[model samples]
Target: MDESLSHNDEAHASSSHSGSRRGGWITFPFITGALVGLTLAAGGWLSNLIVFLIEEFHVKSIDAAQIANVVNGSSSFFPIIGAIVADSLFGSFSVISISSCISLLGIIVLALTAMLNSLRPQPCVVGSELCQPTSTLQDAVLYTGIALASIGLGGTRYTLATMGANQFDKPKNQASFFNWYFFTLYSTTAVALTVIVYIEDNAGWRWGFGLCVLTNIIGLAVFLSGTRFYNIDKPQGSPFVGLARVAVAAFQKRKLQLSSESKDYYDGHDGVKEGIVTGTLSNSFRFLNRAAQKIEGDIRSDGSIAKPWRLSTMQQVEDFKTIIRILPLWSTTIFLSTPLGVQSSMIVLQALSMDRHIGPHFKMPSGSVIVIVLLSTAISLTLIDRFLCPVWQKLTGRSPTPLQRIGLGHVLNVLSMALSALVESKRLKLAKANHLQPVVPMLALWLFPQLVLAGIGEAFHFPGQVALYYQEFPVSLRSTSTAMISLVIGIAFYLSTGVINLVQRVTGWLPNDINNGKLDNVYWMLVVVGVLNFGYYLVCAKLYKYRNVKGADVNSGSADSEK
Candidate 1:
């Protein structure tokens, strides 16, 4: 046993020495550049998709919005699957490399659709009474491009963040990387929203999509160039299988009594050596500890468990409990994200109906208007990291906990929804006074404050959630932890779609033309929902205890509460 531990120590020391020489901040530039290129490519096409569908495909405005929502949802949701694959089969490097290539292909296909007249419906004539619908072939080609792009995005986006974080050994460095990761992400998105959207609106759709293809190729190349500098982690087989084993073992031992003595539980090592876990089992969730309890004949002569379903290691048991404990807190984020998804989709429709002109020469593209959120988020992240965190540390003598940041975000989110409600009400009043014309006289800039507030809210919660999950989740599930936010966003977008559909069917809040509908009421409903969700989040935060808060300096007062 001593020899085995010494070998492990030597291997770890060697790995640390190698890591010091190759990885760390040295790899940041290449990874950051890759991230910027990928974001520019994705944001360019995704942001302008609704407009593309409406103008090129001749789809109805509402249908285009719904399609855009689905695409966004799919892009967000697929990361969970990608993360699982990275954890269980291929590591993040291989998955990211393959996914980037796939994205390049997808962008090329999309560019072809834009350049080829045969791939799209006939252009709608000005002042035409009716527009021709897209044929089956056109629809198939369009969907194929979208599917490929979404899958590619899902596989690469968050996985890259995980890989980048893995390169750094320190938790503080990992946290810093997350802030910069999001900042870079939003900054590139802002460029795409303004510059790329302008190109699409002015130069043409084909040029814009061609640029996406070019950027994707460049990004993939840059990422590949940094291969030697990255400290890549190996796939650790399936963590989910281990989790499942814990549950199965617990059930199989349901009839057996749980032992009070430390010697009675399996700890994934030699029975006489006291095993990996030296301490007494945590009394909380004692029911799950049954899985780790040892019974007669449960262990082989070699100290391996004879039946996998009848016994589990204490570490496995604790990992399962950690997931169970965090689930309620995790669930609150879904509702928080759902309303934002609804607002994002609905806001575009609002911008479409409002006066989009900033000057006689410059009419704002509706897609680019949403960039206000990204811009605000980028700026807010800088402020939070540079200013707010230091002030918080000075005043409180400790940094704000993840829960505190998330709570503040909840407040900001509710306020943003209320602001949106108010803005929409004024816009509706203006439209009603103008006799519900094709376009209202109100400037689309009126929407910026709500978007900015939402952005600030995101700056607070998004990274906080990422940090919380990455810290709390078991080491084996680190990639899965980072991808959890993507899963929440994806589910929320789908729920947003459902909520919008339900609202349209039950009330007059969302018509095909939002200007003719009670759009203000939708925002108000979101505000109400946000408030309720915030209340639920507070309850969960109050009850939840941090499993790994030591040395984190997470507002020691808050840490004390967990005790």
Candidate 2:
């Protein structure tokens, strides 16, 4: 018997050793490079979509802006479903691989549309009655490409972030990976905005979209090449199923008397105590504790639960409670992001109406101006990681908490909107003085400060939100946790469209021609919304207590102190 057990142990140990050797930092470069290529491809097409629709498809500028917002929303929204699919069915590697293929196909179709003259409407001459509308076939082809590309990009983006973090064991290592991940994402996106948008403007849409297709294929190829080195986690049953089971079990056991003894509740398969309460049930969400209450026939002779709906493991119960606790804080971020979405889409219009000339030789594409936000985010992330964080730790003897970082983001976001309002007010004054010409005397560079501030706010809050969710979420739901930020951004973009439509219907704040409208009022309204949202966030953060205070302390040194 001893010899048999020793042989089994040796085999298990050898398998683990092989897996460790095959994965880890050795695969980092390949994954990062794949991400760079993917970002370049996605950004190349998406950044100039509004311009393409207006110039080639003969869509009105405001209509094109709405389409772009919807596309952005869909791209963000589908990731939640993708994360669920990754965690529940396919796993990250399979999902990413499949999504990449789909993206490549979509980009190819999009490139064809750009290259084939019959696939689009006649080129619209600006300020001419000779412009042609798109055919039914052209519309069908364009929408198909948009849908496929959105779905594909959605599936792979945040899922890759989760997969990359899975390669690291330490929380610090995971945090560092997120910083670099966003840095790479923003940097590559900046390149696409400048280079690809320039190509689309100067060389034609065919060459630009062709570049997107080439990069997407390269990204897919690089990802597949690293397959042997990836630490692929197999999909367990859906975590959502486990959470639902907890709720059902609690409801079923509602009439049963509560037990004070620790042993009366199911601990887990190993019979080891694990949760915020350690041995006893946590007092916060007392009703959920009933899910783990041991009753007659709840346990079988083999030590498993006889009735799954009558009893659950303590870990399962706690996981559900953690999600419930974080929801209020999560909600505040939605309002925080809504204004940003509105600002980004509106800025393109603002740039179109303003002087975009940098020199006598060149005029900037409106899409390229948004790269200011990406560049600012990338540079700010580097400075924060290398300099600000270390200096903060030295002076304060602790790193900043996620809540603090998010709070600072809120303040900065409000300031960005306020600055935008002032800038627009000045632009409107200039437009009125210049007799509402197609281009105002004010330079597009005047729009940079607000975008830069918004970018800096993203640098602080985006990674902070990801880290907070990853650290706090249940192990089974970690992938979904990372995708939650994407979900918020998605919903916010949609809501921004609703807000704009409502404003357009009720007031003249957002006419098709922004120069004839009160654009400053819209920015001022966002400032008000941001300030109110920040207050709500403060209340939520203050009332909240960390479930994993020890882990939080190790990560930030100030999480417990804040409580």
Tell me which residue pairs clash in candidate 1.
none
- Candidate 2: minimum summed lDDT over ten consecutive residues — where? 554-563
Write model 1 residue lDDT over 344-428, tens digit each, in one string. Answer: 8888888988999998889998999889888887778778877988899999988888889889999999999999999999998
**lDDT of each residue in 8-107, candidate 2, tens digit only:** 3444467644433244565678788889888899999999998888778878777788888889999999888888888889998999999988888888
Clashing residue pairs in candidate 2 are none
Candidate 2 local lDDT, residue 132: 82
Candidate 1 Cα outliers beyond 4 Å, as residue runs = 1-21, 170-176, 270-278, 554-563
Native-to-model Cα distance after best TM-score fit, residue 372 in candidate 2, in Å: 0.9
